[model samples]
Target: MPHNPISNVQHDVMHSLYMNHHNWLYTWIRRRLDNQFDAADLTQDTFLRIHAKQNVDLINEPKAYLATIAKGLVSHFYRRKSLEQTYLEYLAKQPENLAPSTENQFIILQTLEAIDALLNTLPGHVKEVFLMSQLEGKKYQQIADEMTLSLATVKRYMKQAYVHCFVLMENDFFE
Candidate 1:
């Protein structure tokens, strides 16, 4: 195959960025996480995320760009860890006979992650209202009173949340 000059240029930029900043990025992540293994993994993930974007040439401040991406990855890593810990704690409290098998537990965790991702897509107020109604079983009037929102506003937020979820579900189904 013929060499593509644009692709080669992008590759060169990425290589230069990695060579110049990989160690610094790794150390920065390591300081935040205090875990060499996770730091190394997230550092590589950071590079991979940048590469996937195909915008290496546009970065003016390599360190700042990389730090922003790494920060998000670290946040996600902690969130996932917290979710797993919570699930494990819940499992520990379950009766032995009622506990799910390992495979089932894995499936349940994946489902929970999917649900979390879906909820995260909603606006903060919408998500809070939906959770209060669905998870906490709060009435619309009660939620409105507690949140200082009108009852109609609470109902609208719930409607928005349900529609958002339904659209996402439909897209997933089609995909």
Candidate 2:
């Protein structure tokens, strides 16, 4: 017997899910995740879960489906945050190279969170461009030539990355 219409839809959805929606899904995941690694991992997990489903349809409301996936990702984030806090508390109780003052610890955590939030908002390449220029201290022309992107494109991407990080910072993460 041939596959039913729902099965056919499921096949189609599975085939195209990652390919067609990768960027959108990444953006969605990033909004809720702290950093590039977490965002990338969760985005990959979202697709993996979809793939693992026995059968699913081409969802009439892909946006809604995507939102549901994001919620799960957020829950994962909270769980991770709790574990990290526990690890940090344990580390505090251990002998260390240096003890962190409460203010310094707060600053470090805020910086990490800000970095995570910024990374989530940025596109992969844009984030790369910004990192290459800022973290590596490369010139814009150098970044453009290295990435084989146009100078204007590199500048635009950097500008977008800056705006994203700036907005996150302005939210008073440092305060």
Candidate 3:
């Protein structure tokens, strides 16, 4: 079978891209994530995403595309970091600190796992609003405006969501 010249060029470009920058991708992610294991995972995920997209001819610069994918990984990492920080701040206010003991890092990890589960249980709009307000530092009125909802509706949603999150934390039950 004869391959078209354009197809051959694309294949050569993609192959060279894979060869030249693959190892550097992990370093790029590790710099942002500060964890080699997670960096390897993210680097693999980046290439997997590029492969899944099959965007050979469309991307003018392969390095730029890799950088964009790495940036996305960084953004996701920071988003989770912010979520964990918010959860920790919430936990700090509780009367009981379950992870207070020196060897109770396991307990803290478990508590964070439960909080993550509970966060997923929230309604879409409510969750977005909560994230905007608490994580992104948006004001209530700002969230209402951004969501195109009445201020009272925003307030009600936030209150209900907060109460649910608080109760879940208080009970130490995520289900």
Candidate 4:
């Protein structure tokens, strides 16, 4: 292959950034998380996220940039952990014979994560309306009553949410 000066410069900058800040980032994440293992994993994830952007050369304050990425990751880690804990607790309450197999449990958890991600993309009111109708089995009128929204507004929000989900699924299918 040909020598690429730009690639080499980016590589060197990334290497320097990682070498200078890896320890500090790890310690910072470790301070927020109880598990050392999770802290380590998230620190690596933070670096991977930055690498994906291919903008290491643009970062002027390396530590601040790293901390910002790490903070978002830490929030995501806790949210996923909380979701898993809730699922496990629900499973624990199920009759032993009714419990899902480990493989199914994993699949269900992944589906939940995907669903959560999709919902996060929707506008707040739309998500709330959709969740009320789908998850809580509430009627449009009931949702309207509870939220102080008109029935027509509730229906509009639900339509918006459904269209958002459909567009995302269509994109995924094509991809």
Angstrom error at residue 23, model 3:
1.8
lDDT tens digits by residue: candidate 1, 31-67: 9999999999999999999999998999999999999
CA displacement after TM-score superposition, residue 22 of candidate 1 (Å): 0.8
Query: Where does candidate 4 have its weakest 10-residue lDDT segment?
Result: 166-175
Give the TM-score (vs. native) of candidate 1. Answer: 0.90
Give the clashing pairs for model 1.
Answer: none
Indicate whether candidate 2 or candidate 4 has the larger lDDT.
4
Q: Judged by TM-score, which candidate is best?
A: 4
Q: Which stretches of candidate 4 lie above 4 Å from their native place?
A: 1-3, 173-175
Whole-structure CA lDDT of model 2: 0.77
Model 4 lDDT per residue over 74-97, tens place: 998888888899999999999999
Candidates 2 and 3, the one with greater lDDT: 3
Tell me how candidate 4 scores on lDDT. 0.92
lDDT of 2 by residue, 80-118 (tens): 597569648866897777767778876776666656565
Please report how far candidate 2 places residue 94 from its true position, in Å: 3.6
| Cα-based TM-score, every candidate | 0.90, 0.44, 0.47, 0.91
Clashes of each: 0, 1, 0, 0
Residue 88, model 4, lDDT: 100
Candidate 4 residue-wise lDDT at 111? 84
Prediction 3 TM-score vs. true:
0.47
Which pairs clash in the backbone of model 2? 34-116
